[model samples]
Target: MSDSYPQSALREWRAHMGHPATLVAILGVGLVLGVAGPFGTDVRLTLLPRIAYWLITVLLTYSAGTLCDAMLKRPLARFGFWVHLAVTALATGVAILLVLLVVNYIVYGWLPDRDSLPAFLGTNFAIAIIVSVVLATVHRQSTPVEIVSNPVRILDRLPLDKRGPLVALSVEDHYVRVQTTRAEDLILMRLSDAIAEVGDTKGAQVHRSHWAAFEHVTTARREGDRAILTMNTGTDIPVSRANVAKIKEAGLLP
Candidate 1:
């Protein structure tokens, strides 16, 4: 049985996919292409080659999904994690097949003229299922790294190793959440200065008190007067009214 975790765990998955908006965009484009393929000239290919092509597409999508899942130590703890993963995987497969269909249509006039529509759909769905299963298994097999904390490096010292990666620090009550590796580290420091010191990682202060890793933010949601950033960890970080414009200008918002 799978263990339970918070919704925040999905942050990494969402972020790695380039966010929900990106996936939706990919799917929309795929749908348009899939329908257009039937009129393409390459429709003469036999059933066997078409099957092979779809299988290849599944493999590619599976690889991409597995790569994304590998980034998280544990899978996202949601009510329907497996279901969601399966859907996302199949959707990704469809998007890929649609792209191929569109390509065939543009280059040629008809696609799979030798085969029926039912056969193509059947083949694509079957391959999607297989790829999704393989990708999920691969994700389950990934090894997770253990992180240890060092409490000695408090604000008492001036700072010794300033040359290393700039760790953007923020104190969240008792814990200091350091935004790095798209993972958070509990440390002790003020958030204000931490954002200024983080040199290598490109990010910004989405909130008056919150510092966000630019690359880590997958999507931004506008909730009334407030803006929330869905981070790599899936936790929503509020974007202060003052910083909303700047974050939008940075292209962090959809």
Candidate 2:
């Protein structure tokens, strides 16, 4: 999968964390919350301290959420949404509450009263469920690669972002580097089997280990008895003498 596209729950969360936009989001949301000072934080602390408080709290919760998502995946992968939400809320709520105990102590100089512990836990659970649902929704947005006429079996092996119109395929040991208009991916499949899955795409195996789509062949030039085909992606594929006729027949060469 592309690092940008959302995938499995944990992986998707991790990928998002690596994006620059995620940092922007974290900083923006922290600033807003600090200014607004939810739960009386604005009243309790000065402006700079308020911003610092929310910023560190935001950072802690984000780290806790990532950890909780990973920990809960194995147990919840087979479960449905309600079960996931309830369990996720509990797990993440507990994890964050533990860390927040220290944060609260540092900010306020003491924890909430023992009698108010349940209320604190409840607040954590509510926040956890909201964050869980949003992350789950992001994870669900990934679309699987679809292939062939009915569905190409080989294209399914490529990542979602790499699934586009056919370009070329090249063999590298046990793997075939499948290229589409969008990008290329190395799939663990034979060149022959990959070509069989080309379906409606008009292309030919121009070399013993290379295949080129006719529509994507940008230049075809004769090289003595053999030929060279340059694809739209600027990949030059050497066409063996035996396949020269096929390339010519496809009008890839004059």
Candidate 3:
């Protein structure tokens, strides 16, 4: 069960990296670079050896870059597109450069001298930015863009990463706990105010301190004088006596 947000992220990461097109693209890049034999490899080695070098370099660099990108992309999403792109690119660039350095060292048996380091690093960083822009665009296109256009004013209270279908809400002192399908976070607002901001989403304040979306209500059972409504997120919210009929009217329970 995806009770954990981190587990949800891990599953998405696996699906993205293991896609058949991604695998083919990796192979295609390696093959194209192998044939091109850039960076003096054509002069230094025979055709087959040069091809192998490019293939290995591309494979190693892509592996490092993709892993770094996956790790940072979600966390940085809150920062907006440009900031996220710059940060992820720099980080993923460093990872790719380090792997590229190792692979290049194996081929030439030498490291860059101090004088050439600046140019070498600058070239790699520039390349990294271009790669990052492409990646960021692809991801942006694939991601659903509902939050910006959504009529629900309450969604504005959540970070981009935590925003999704509403599950439940609760008051903890001064903070209102907003639980969405993707992740949950607390906003400093009264329970009543939060419920008001829910806008068009079909939901109700189940208790004085709790709110639950109608579609997200999964199970309900009577406990003593009150009823407990189970949300799809596995949270059991205590229903007040006053709202018990309201819950029954929603067809969530008999």
**Model 2, residue 163: displacement in angstroms?**
12
Error of 3 at 131 (Å): 1.3
Tens digits of per-residue lDDT, candidate 2, 1-254, equal: 11221233345455546556667778998899889999888779988899989988887887787667655544554564457656876777777877788899987997878898889877876787677677655543323445335455556665454567888888755556677776554454568988988877888998999998899988889989999898887678889999999988987777
* Per-prediction TM-score: 0.34, 0.50, 0.55
> What would the per-residue lDDT of candidate 1 be over residues 5-95, giving only the tens digit for each residue?
3333344334444544445555555444443433331275445544444444333454355343333323322324455466556665566
Show where candidate 2 strays beyond 4 Å. 1-15, 80-82, 141-254
Which regions of candidate 3 deviate over 4 angstroms?
1-11, 142-254
Q: In candidate 1, how many Å is residue 3 off?
A: 16
Arranged by lDDT with the best first, the candidates are 3, 2, 1
Candidate 3 lDDT (Cα, whole model)?
Answer: 0.73
Off by over 4 Å in 1: 1-169
RMSD of 1: 14.4
Residues 54-118 of candidate 3 have per-residue lDDT tens digits of 77777677766766665665566556556767887888888888887888788788688999899
**Residue-level error in angstroms, candidate 2, position 128:** 2.3
